[model samples]
Target: MDALTSVTGDGQHIEPRTEFAPLAVMALTGGEPAGGQMVSFFVDDPEGTGTDFHGGSPVRVTTASDGTGTTDVPLLAGEAPGTVEVKVIADGAHTSFSLTVNGHPEGNSGA
Candidate 1:
């Protein structure tokens, strides 16, 4: 399979400078799982924003023999809330998705 089938996150809003549950990426072949593959994760920050991948981006991860992988994307503290584009590539197939970051409310400590 050369196409990304699906991309999803564990939460809708991500807290800045925090490591949340990984975003899941799925690959498929003929509607079936394309397992045992190597995939790479990338983040596209056009404006040189404060988003940080924690040395995670541009990294390759092997699928769990089920055509599924996870990406750990983190933002720096004081980073503005906005949408970010994430690119995934595998075996000449590539796809992109947008992730939204939610701002922490004032006077509320992010615990």
Candidate 2:
């Protein structure tokens, strides 16, 4: 069976409308790298107050030699406090990254 998992940029706390770390996923089939595979990214913001893929959702990318796929673009927090969900799909396998857009950063008074 193939596998897809978020290797980074998951369960992070981000401030509203701010830039955070990059997201990446690994695609493996039978415990081996699934290179040259096409990985698709999607955004699930039910509150409509979260981020999206830079050019929009459903961004497609080909995995590298090490079975790694990354979002080459930037993903910022939305206009309000909410959770942003990024769903990664790879050859019928799936994984996800969740980020919370909390209000205000440390030492910021929202002034």
Candidate 3:
């Protein structure tokens, strides 16, 4: 099976300027879930912009043997703004990235 990764937003309103870093790259060698392992992705606040992921711990992205993964991580809540670092880990290997969070209001956006 092939490994697949995706990012999704919950029902919460998201800004149009929201951006995503690249997924941590990895090489799968096992045959399937039985022998295969799980991969993880992390998101962190670098500049301390007050975003969700900034003050709190890093968000994690995990991959199962099904070769499927979800990156439904959340960042800060208020309008402080901040940067994010995305990291992925697999089979002892890992990668990371950083991104800026833009400003936006909160409400029932038709998102």
Candidate 4:
């Protein structure tokens, strides 16, 4: 439910939002015109009780393509909407942002 922002290497900005759903999981991944590599994104659901909105289960999401700036993350089974922590390690190349579950900016339910 909190606002998230994505920063660029040289202090640029790209604010985006994603939706939540039955297969909702905080997405993690990115791409740049040039430079930046050896990075990994992880989502964690620390509670481990099918709760814990703040991601602590540590789900790894890979780029949609080899060099695409997109990742598809699947939420944990029976995961209830709440808060989750999304960690992005992009070799300190690009800044990261939070993608909310059940929070669709376009108001389009995947289902």
lDDT of each: 0.67, 0.85, 0.46, 0.34
Q: Residue 1 CA error for candidate 4 (Å)?
A: 30
Better of 1 and 2 by lDDT: 2
The residue-by-residue lDDT of candidate 4 on 44-95, one tens digit each, is 5453324322354333333332333333443332233334444555434333
- Candidate 3 residue runs with Cα over 4 Å from true position: 1-27, 30-36, 53-62, 72-78, 104-111
Clashing pairs in 3: 49-81, 49-82, 51-76, 52-75, 52-76, 53-75, 53-76
Candidate 1 matches the true fold with a TM-score of: 0.73
What value does the lDDT take at residue 12 in candidate 2? Answer: 90
Tens-digit lDDT track of model 3 for 45-109: 46655444433445454555545454455454434455555565666655554455555556639
When 1 and 4 are scored with TM-score, the better candidate is 1
Estimate, for each residue in 2-94, the C-alpha lDDT of model 1 and write its tens digit. Answer: 567546762345776655446678888777788887888777766444565676467577777778987644533226666666677898888
Using lDDT as the measure, name the better of candidate 1 and candidate 4: 1
- Sort by TM-score, best first: what order? 2, 1, 3, 4
Off by over 4 Å in 2: 105-111
Sliding window of 10 residues with minimal summed lDDT for model 3: 3-12
TM-score of each: 0.73, 0.87, 0.45, 0.36
The worst-scoring run of ten residues by lDDT in candidate 2 lies at 102-111
Shift of residue 82 alpha carbon in model 3, Å: 3.5
lDDT tens digits by residue: candidate 2, 1-111 = 299988989999877877868889999989998899999888898877768767778888889999999888778778777887889998799999988889655666757
